[model samples]
Target: MINQNVTKRPVRIGLQLQPQHMDYATIRRVASKAEELGADILFNWDHFYPLYGEKDGLHFECWTMLAAWAESTSRVEIGALVTCNSYRNPELLADMARTVDHISDGRLILGIGSGWFERDYAEYGYEFGTAGGRLDDLATALPRIESRWGKLNPPPTRKIPVLIGGGGEKKTLRLVAKHADIWHSFADADVLEHKLGVLHGHCETVGRDPAEIEVSVEIGGSTDPKDGDRFRELGASLFTVGVGGPDPDLGPLREWLAWRDATNE
Candidate 1:
């Protein structure tokens, strides 16, 4: 588990450069622009195809783009919004993460979750198991992931923060308590508050400190700054604003970054 207290972290905004309906050139430009505008973390999603807009629209792979971002951008930490764990072997994922970490000079956050998209599973020939079974797979994978990180020839540049994304109380939150350095979830203020209570209870059972795990919210950049204030009061430190591709508008990202700076101050 991460040793730092959550209260010690300043509010930071993230931008998910969603890789759909656009060419790589456009996506690449947005990444650099987000950092220039002061986004603290930059993210992309792991999917074989588009999640929305169109079924067969333009899309790019997650980790490959991340590798490029590692080389291209200088300041913002880069990662997938949450990689599907079922896509690759846990050991291989650890290795890929390490390579990216070294490439980015240790600015990679391994945001991951159990497989979710049916299309990604069907198209990729992965078994779309029951939710319980998939959560179990993630449970089994986390230790192997950590162990593999330890045994790599050239270790991760840093501890390589694990950001687990999901809000399942029994399994996902338990996994987060046991494994994650950051927890990403989608919830309004009340739901988030309730989830944090559940997460803290899980931490207690596992002998982990609740504050060691950072809270992250998924949102659009245009979301209200008032809502952001509510989230901060609930202990959320990271906000990820998702922008879709094919001439994506970055206005919300700029607005949120200003909010981030103001909140941090």
Candidate 2:
């Protein structure tokens, strides 16, 4: 059971349409279906190639597909489950996010991280540097992203919500405390509880309210709402279900949405 004090917000569900082993047409169709089915957010990942299946499997770029999703879906907030920071210049990425925000009429969440995927870096001509270095760059890039958003021609339609994905106690959570509107992590309930304490500590250090940041977690394939009980009890409001491509099934997504609706009510 969720503590009444902690789970204050309405439960929201997200669908990550993995852009792997699928044609553009299929991806587009699924995006449409996800929106029609009442997803609060629609997400894709930032990667040059498939993360699983065949290494040479069919895949698509992240932002361009987000642009398409903006044009296609009227309601769901759209973005990468997280865009990798090293893939593009932070200022340019900020501009791109602003553009998509306009296209979606102010419904874009700028979910980002200090990128991993070595293959994306090596093949795309980016420096596949040390993890610590990448985190340093992300720490540096975020302010520039916000500054760029301020100077844009027309500016973003609204203050775009920043969603930071990662669980590093020292660096990542600190960044989340300083900048993020939402903090996403893959930690299970026990781990999430510990991380939330770390996050709250970071918030205190940074002079930000920890309650201002909505917690997001990956809810695995189980359709039973009981499977999400622990996470819900810990105050994870935004739950994401990932569906893969090339004839993907949305049954699980539907189940999760039902869970979301029931919980919210």
Candidate 3:
């Protein structure tokens, strides 16, 4: 369980506008609505094509869209749900994140993951290696990302928060313990409890304080304010709900916002 004293701060809400089959116009509108509704953060998935249904559906690049989102919204924080490591070089990715961080005036959260999806690798001309190999790549790239951030002509104006998303026990959680400001995972109450236990153990192994790492979960419609309260009890302070395209719905978002406000009050 999360240390209650450590998590006295109110829970935050994040919305992921999974860009699967939506056009640019719809994406813009949904982002605007999320900001208008007081979502703490707005996110887009990093994929070249739709991950579901028809694979070759409408899609857009992650960083480019994030740049646009930075310009479009004034108050909401924006970033990719998890930018694939294989899509760009580590230094370049760091630079891109710094640029967007400035564009949003310090509202960018850099969420990264070990590259997955065989289709993304094959279509984009990247080698699809074993899962362990990909995790190894991510491990190597993280420090380079930090190094390039320092070497950049203009360092990121704000300390961009690093969020690592994945639930692998051996490597992914270890990476989170080492480098992540926030760790996102998809699991139910029992599963989440187990993962948190493992993550705590990893933190101990690395000589890092577990409380320094924020825990997040990606939830669906079945999760609501009550469910969120239960998750909070379990140590999840950042709760994200995923909305898929085309014509994504914001009804649940509004409710979650209300829940956030109510809980915080």
All candidates: TM-score: 0.97, 0.97, 0.97
Q: What is the lDDT of residue 185 in candidate 3?
A: 89
Task: Flag regions of model 3 displaced more than 4 Å.
Answer: none
Worst 10 residues of 2 by lDDT: 1-10
Candidate 2 local accuracy as lDDT?
0.91
The runs of at least 3 residues in candidate 2 whose Cα sits more than 4 Å from the true structure, single-residue gaps closed, are: 1-6
- In TM-score terms, candidate 2 sits at 0.97
Per-residue error (Å), model 2, residue 77: 0.7
TM-score of 3: 0.97
| Model 3 per-residue lDDT tens digits across residues 147-258 | 8998998999877899999999999999999999999988887888889999999999999988888888887654467887767877788888888888898888888888
Model 1 sits at a Cα RMSD from the real structure of 2.4
Q: lDDT per residue, candidate 2, 109-196, as tens digits? A: 9999999999999988999899899999999999999999999999999999999999999899999999999999998888999999
* Candidate 1 segments exceeding 4 Å error: 1-8
lDDT of 1 by residue, 79-195 (tens): 998999999999999999999999999999999999789889998899998889999999999999999999998999899999999999999999999999999998877888889
Q: Which candidate leads in lDDT?
A: 2
Where does candidate 1 clash, by residue pair? none
